[model samples]
Target chain A: MATIETTGLTKSFGDVHAVEDLDLTVEEGEIFGFLGPNGAGKSTTINLLLDFIRPTSGNIEVLGIDAQERPAAVRRRVGVLPEGFGFDDPLLGREYLEWAIETKEADDDPDELIDLVGLTGDADRLAADYSTGMQQRLAFAMALAGDPDLLILDEPSTGLDPNGIQNMREIVREQAERGTTVFFSSHHLAEVEAVCDRVGVMNEGELVAVDTIEGLRESAGGPATIQLECATPPTELGVADLDVVTDVAVDERTLSVTCTGASAKVDVVTHVAERAEIVDILSESVSLEALFNDLTDGGRDGDDADSEQAATEVAQ
Target chain B: MSVRTVAKQDFLSARRSRALWFATTLFALLAVLIAYGSQGYRLSATEQVQNTFRSFGMVLAVLLPIVALVASYMSIAGERESGGIKFLLSFPNTRRDVFLGKLASRLAVVAAGLTFIFLAATAVAVARHGAFPVGVVLGTYLVSLLYGSVFVAVAVALSSAVGARSRAIGAAVGSYFVLIVLYLVPTIRITALVQWVHDTMLGMEPNPHLYDAVTYTSPYIAFRKALNLVLPTEMQQEVFRGSLEAGGELPVYLTDEFSLVVFAVWLTVPLVVGYVRFEGSDLE
Candidate 1:
């Protein structure tokens, strides 16, 4: 079953539209990354899904319940890690974890989870005494509590070290493997690229693209590159004149050519062989970077909205 | 955790804090001194001192709201400001459970504090007057406390409404001040129409009458009236003797039980409002 489905979701704050005409669906047990820039409507859309804010126009169903009409029912089955959480209480880190278990009516080994977050030592200490990272881990633990069916994480790795970042990615992967639908939003494009099975890119309050990383890369632009190293130089090789060729730069023993497509790759190899010593030939595929740039920069001065950029932009 | 568990933990946590210990010690000392120092306390001479303490001490009308604001109003907002609320709310618990759990904890602490103060006061009275009207004191204390609980509930709602730390703090304090302006003082009650619209928040009926209605409306005043009603004939005679005027009637309204009903209403109304808001609020 689809864990979440939103039809034409729209939210407005006064005159500004934070999220508009957003249509999205997440399958069960999938790691869906809602990727966007800082102001992209990712968080706003998530808020709407969680029923933290009402949609100006649209319908949302999460966990098989209407988001606005039955938020508590949906909330009971979903775990959320909000962007910024603050509280002052004397409860220990582990105590908070235990409280989550009670709230969800689920049995969880808080000690084990605490260890997973590297908060074993601080388990007995008041949350106020722990460092920000430890506290954040505590938040993550809470989200994991009750073994929720659907997990919603918003910028979950904002305040973490490299090791912490790795643990976060692993934790999400582990949950997804366990059949927990994972829907999260992040401004960290690399993180999204790494673990996300599919990504919804947004800019200026709209989703421009929603597909796998490979699909995005393909749609972004041309794939791979061909590098040629020859036995002879002095502009002897016609590397730049080929129809498929875009630009060519020669440094000593190597020739680097930018091409529109890989169609001309064979002809270039033959040309290099005829004019110079075919010492080595290297070809590389186009990266998401290239694709993202092309897809986002296609419009004139943003006159034409880039699907990926529009997906990432938050109206508010 | 169960509500009981939440309340129990709150109690244990409060016991560990220095604030509780400090406040308790002060109450103990004051109670012992007052009980012993007033041996054969006569009404006429003591009334002067009683009135002074009445206006200055914690039982003043203003104290109840202050206690509620300080203890419960800041509960959630403080957490949000420190970024700890996110951790708590992330749990599978509904916002209602979160609010109720915290409310239960604060109430337990407040109840403990009120109980201690009353016990100490009784101890002092016994030591000085040779015998204390325990029933009167106990009855009055309950009435006053029920009224105070109303503030706690409303304060919690206010705290939830204001999410940021500094702003929440200001709102709590400012609302408390507004309450005082509208509730304690009568002349100021005569205000511009806008002021009435603002003051309507104080109460739907506006406590109606101030010190006079304190019996059925105000917590401490209601408690005082109830205590006077429950006092034994001998103590009543003694109380009458100790009045500011040697022979005057202490105000009485339909016996002391009216105070209990008013206190109940005071507590029930605000709690209902808070719970309803909390159950449905977005809490973002």
Candidate 2:
């Protein structure tokens, strides 16, 4: 069964369409990453799933329950680290964890959850006075209170350092290992790349792509570039028959080849070695960051006129 | 169960407030001072006790509402503005739990403060006069609590209805002006204006009962009127007492029973209005 599902979900604030016609589903025990840039409706979609805001039109179900009709019941089984949340009250870190436990009627120990989040030493301090990273860790501990079946983290690494972000990745991995489904949103491609089993990319309040990293690379069609320092440049390499090679160039003793897919690089290397003596091989794989930029940029440039038309229709 | 947990969390957090402690201590000190100063009256023991109670009640009428308002006006609105309520509602607790829990917590704080003040006053009276009017003190404490709850309900309702802390503060201070200050400070001018309009503009005879009705609309006045149910009859602060002594009957609306109803209205109406708004609003 799907842990979180939304069909045609949309939310608008006056003239602004924060989320539009969003359809999403995260299966149980799967770590699904939600990716988007700023104002791309990632957080707004999460908010709609959690029932923090009402949808303009559509349905949302979490844990197979209608979110809008019984939000508290949905939340009872789901743990959330909401975006832009703070500890304005004067409760200590442990106190907040304890409150979460008692509120959820869970039997988990507070100190253990604190230890899980690497906040054992800071659990006795006032949460309001903690640094931003410490507060994020505390919020994570609170969300882990009940060993909830599903965890929704919105920008969970907003204020973390490099080490803290690494720790967050490990904690998320550990939770998923315990058979918990994780739904996390982030603009950072590397963060999602490190832990997600599948990803959904959102742009302009609409879902642009949903696939595994490999599938995304395939659909994005980013090329792998291979450079060779050969013993000597050879003319007529006879590599023209290869389909994956997009381009090939040789200057003096150097040869550069651009191609798609992993095996194609090996194929190109073999083709080059058959014709000349090879010295050194240098290869560059496609980075998801560049792919992400391309995807979002394409959304903006390609759909500019379409979105304007939709806005006018909405206005009418 | 969720309501109780939310209430407990709110109360524990509120316990750290310096303002709550300061107000509690201040009221207790004032009670002690009133007890010591009232010893010079030459009346009988009962009369002197009644006189001291009247003076203390007057001070309490002003102080309790302000304390209640200040303590409660920021309960929901402040958290909403600071994005802390997102952390709260991220759990399984409903909006009703949050609203009623805050009301319960503020009511508990006000009740705890009243306990300190009344205990201090009773202790001093027992030490100085060698007497304790158990019924009177207890009754007066309950009445003060009801009055305090009225203001707390008003303030929490204001907090829940608005999205911003500044708006809540504006509403709270605005309510203080309209309900307490206007009734307490400019009584003579307001009364003269009402009388002039009633007699001159409308060309009608002056009705003192009209003044009583208008004044009693303020919770402060209604609270004072309700206290007559507990205090000695001679010491009761009843409106229209002069005309009643001259063979005029008091209107049912002016009776102490109706003031209790007024207290009831003030308590429930604001809560219902606030809950309706709070339940439907988006947390963003």
Candidate 3:
């Protein structure tokens, strides 16, 4: 079942269309990463799903309920850590967590949540005195109140050190393991690749791509590069003619071939072995960071084209 | 449930603030000063009690609204400006709940402060004069609470309507001047000036109803009229005669009942306007 779904979702502020014709879905129990550059409408889409801003046109459903029509019902089952959220400074961190527990009517012990977020020592201190990272941890713990079925985290890893990031990743994994659907947006490509089961890439208010990490690499034409160390360098090997081999280059004693997928690696090896005695082979795959940059760079070009058209219209 | 939770949070947070403490202390000090300070006049027991109530009421006409405004102006705008309202709204609470909850919590604080002031003044009055007018004191306290609520509602309404904290504070202060100071001080002078212009320049009879209308618009004057209902008839006539022609009766619209209605309207109008605007605007 889809935990979240949006159809033709759009939001505009006067002349600026912040989000346009966006359709997305996050299934139950999957860690879905919402990836985008700054101002790519990632936050806007989250706000729309949460009904913080009314959509110009679209339908949004969270936990199988129309969020705009029944936002309270949707909010009850979902815990959200909104981007740029501020804490009530005078309240102690423990007080904040207890309030969250009360507001959500959750039976979870606040102490356990404090421990989960590694804020046990500072929980009794005023939130105003907490460091940025400590505040983020407190917000994360609050988001876990009620053991919500869905967690919507926007920029959840922001203001965290490396250790905090690792702790956050572990909590997300644990939540997903407990059958909670996690929908998080972040600019941290590496972290998203580490935790998200499926990723959606949004660009310029449009969802340009959605797939598994490996699937995204494949769609970007980033194939695995395989290097073969041969007993004898073979000449005139038509590895390029093979369907799986995207490109092949021969260096003195080693032949390198790029293959489109995992299965293609086998075919390339077989084809190379037939020509030369294969002693050893090494393979490397492209990273999600490269794929994200590739996708957004392409998105930027589309934006440039759109602005050029707009400029010409103004001139006319 | 959500409204109550929001209100509880607001009340707890405000209870920890320094401003509430300062306001309460100031009100207590002023109450004692007004009751005991007037003992030097050597007036009778009834005169002493009436004088103390009038002096406290006059001070409250300026002081209580400032206290209420100080306590409440940041209630909604500060949260919205800091992005805390985003987390708040992420809960099951509606926008209307947030507005009402804030108003309700601040009202509790103001009511508590007013009660303390009233008790302090009453104690001083009884100890200094050997007597206290329970009916007048209670009535004055009730009217003062209503008057202070008008300012509290205005401050909260302005806070909710604006996004920036600095802007909200500016508006709240500006509104304090317009409602408490400008309406009370200038209406009397402006009314006199207009009457003079009509009598001298326009060669016409100055309209009496105009003066009544302008004066009653001031919440301070409305509170005074309401307090008159419980005072002795001699004192009531004495207070009115000072402000009106010696032989003329008070205007119909300036009746105690009408003043109460006006106070009620002052409390509701700003709050409703703020709630409606708050409900319609985006939280961002």
Candidate 4:
């Protein structure tokens, strides 16, 4: 069964459309990464799923239950780590975890959850006094309460050190291994690449692409490069003349070939080997960064400068 | 059941608030000192107790609302402003639970403060004269609890109506001025305006019952009138002579028990309206 499903979901703040025409589905136990830039409406869509904000028009189902009609029931089975949340003052970190456990009617030990987040000694201290990273860890432990069947994490890597980030990722993987569906949202490509089974890319309040990392690269048809170290300084040998190959550069005893698609790498290698002896060949597949840049608007640019440049172009 | 957990968590937070404790202590001390100071009037034990009730009721009418508003005005809005509402709603509890739980906690805090103040005042009267009116004091305390709950309801309702802390404070203080002071006081009572309109436009004599209708609508006035239920017969005449002097049998709704209904209405209407606004609006 699908853990989450949305149809024609839309949310608008007056004239600004924060999320528009969003249709999404996450299967049971799948780690689905929601990817976008800073202002891509990723948070807005997550808020809609949790029913923290009402949709302008559409439907959402979580764990096969209507999210809008019974949000608290859906949340009872799903744990959420929202973006930009603060702990209530005068509450200890351990108290927060215990409160989560009590509220969910779960029997998990708060001490064990505290140890999992590495806040054993600091759990008794007030959460208001904890540093940003410690607070993030505490929130993660709270979300782990009740052994929820679904986890919705928005920017889980916001204030984590490298070790903390790795710990969080491992915990997420462990939860997924327990057959818990995870909906992870982040702007960081590398983090998503590591754990996401499939990713959906959102841009300007619309979903632009949804596929596996390798599938996105393939479908994007981005540039792939191959380096050839020849027995001597090699000639182009009509490598650039081939329609698939985009650019060819020659250096001392090495020839580099850039191609637009996967087929071009084989064509370039065969063409080079027929003419000259190839000593060493290294090929690199396209990175998600490039595909992401292509899918989005050349990645995030300075808004002021981009608008000014656009204004000048319009004037011209 | 979820409301219990939310209320418990909220109460635990309120328990640690030094500001609430400080205000309770200050109010208790002031009430005791004022109750003892009224001894300068050479009076019998009964008169002394009546004097205490009169002075305490007057002070409570003015002070309890401030404490109740201070305790509750930020219950929802502060959490919303600090991004804490996200953490709260991320749990299984619904928005209704959050709203009602917050109301419960604020009421509990105000109830505790009122208990201390009333007990202190009663204890001082008993300690001074070695005996006091037990049933009357208990009845007065019950009515005072209802009165405090009315203000807490208004304050929490105001808190739920807005997202910003500044706006909540503004709304709360504004309501206080209009409901507590401007509706019954020397500045300009709503009844005075209505009486002026009655005399000028309708060209009629100033109707005393019309004044009673408009004046008793204020929670402050309703509280004072409700005290007539517990006050001795003579003291009741001294407090509520205006209606008695009207020289006609009063309407049933104008009775002291009817003011309880007024208290009930004030307690409920604001909360229902606030919850409707809260349930439909988006959280940040």
Could you tell me every candidate's TM-score relative to the true structure? 0.78, 0.90, 0.91, 0.95
Q: Summing lDDT over every window of 10 consecutive residues in candidate 2 chain B, give the lowest-scoring window.
A: B238-247
Candidate 3 residues A138-175, lDDT tens each? 99998899999999999998999999999999999999
Better of 1 and 2 by TM-score: 2
Model 3 alpha-carbon miss at residue B58, Å: 0.4
Residue-wise C-alpha lDDT for candidate 1, range B169-215, written one tens digit per residue = 78778776655545445454333333355456544443222223332
Q: What is the DockQ (computed on Cα atoms) for candidate 2? A: 0.67
Which pairs, if any, clash in model 3? none
Model 4 lDDT per residue over A77-157, tens place: 989898988876698998988999999999999999999988889999999999999999999999999999999999999
- Clashes (candidate 3): 0
- Measured with C-alpha atoms, the lDDT of residue A159 in candidate 2 is 87
Instruction: Give the distance in Å from residue A75's predicted Cα in candidate 1 to where it truly belongs.
Output: 3.3
- Per model, state how many residue pairs clash: 38, 0, 0, 0
DockQ of each: 0.33, 0.67, 0.68, 0.81
CA lDDT of A289 in candidate 1?
46
Worst 10 residues of 1 chain B by lDDT: B237-246
Residues B1-284 of candidate 3 have per-residue lDDT tens digits of 88898889888888888867887987798799888887546668977898788777778877888888888899899989898898888887777778888889988988988898888889988898987778888888888888888888988998899988899889988887766676566444655665677778888966755655666777766777776776767566332332376346666775667888888888888888988888778777
Candidate 2 per-residue lDDT over residues B14-86, each given as its tens digit:
8988878987898799899997688545777666666677778888888888989999999899878888778
The parts of candidate 3 lying over 4 Å away from their true place are A222-224, A240-249, A258-267, A298-316, B40-42, B186-188, B192-206, B237-243, B246-251
Name the regions of candidate 1 deviating beyond 4 angstroms: A222-225, A230-243, A250-253, A261-279, A284-286, A289-316, B1-17, B20-33, B39-62, B178-265, B272-282
Candidate 2: misplaced stretches above 4 Å? A221-224, A228-234, A238-247, A259-283, A298-316, B39-41, B187-211, B240-247
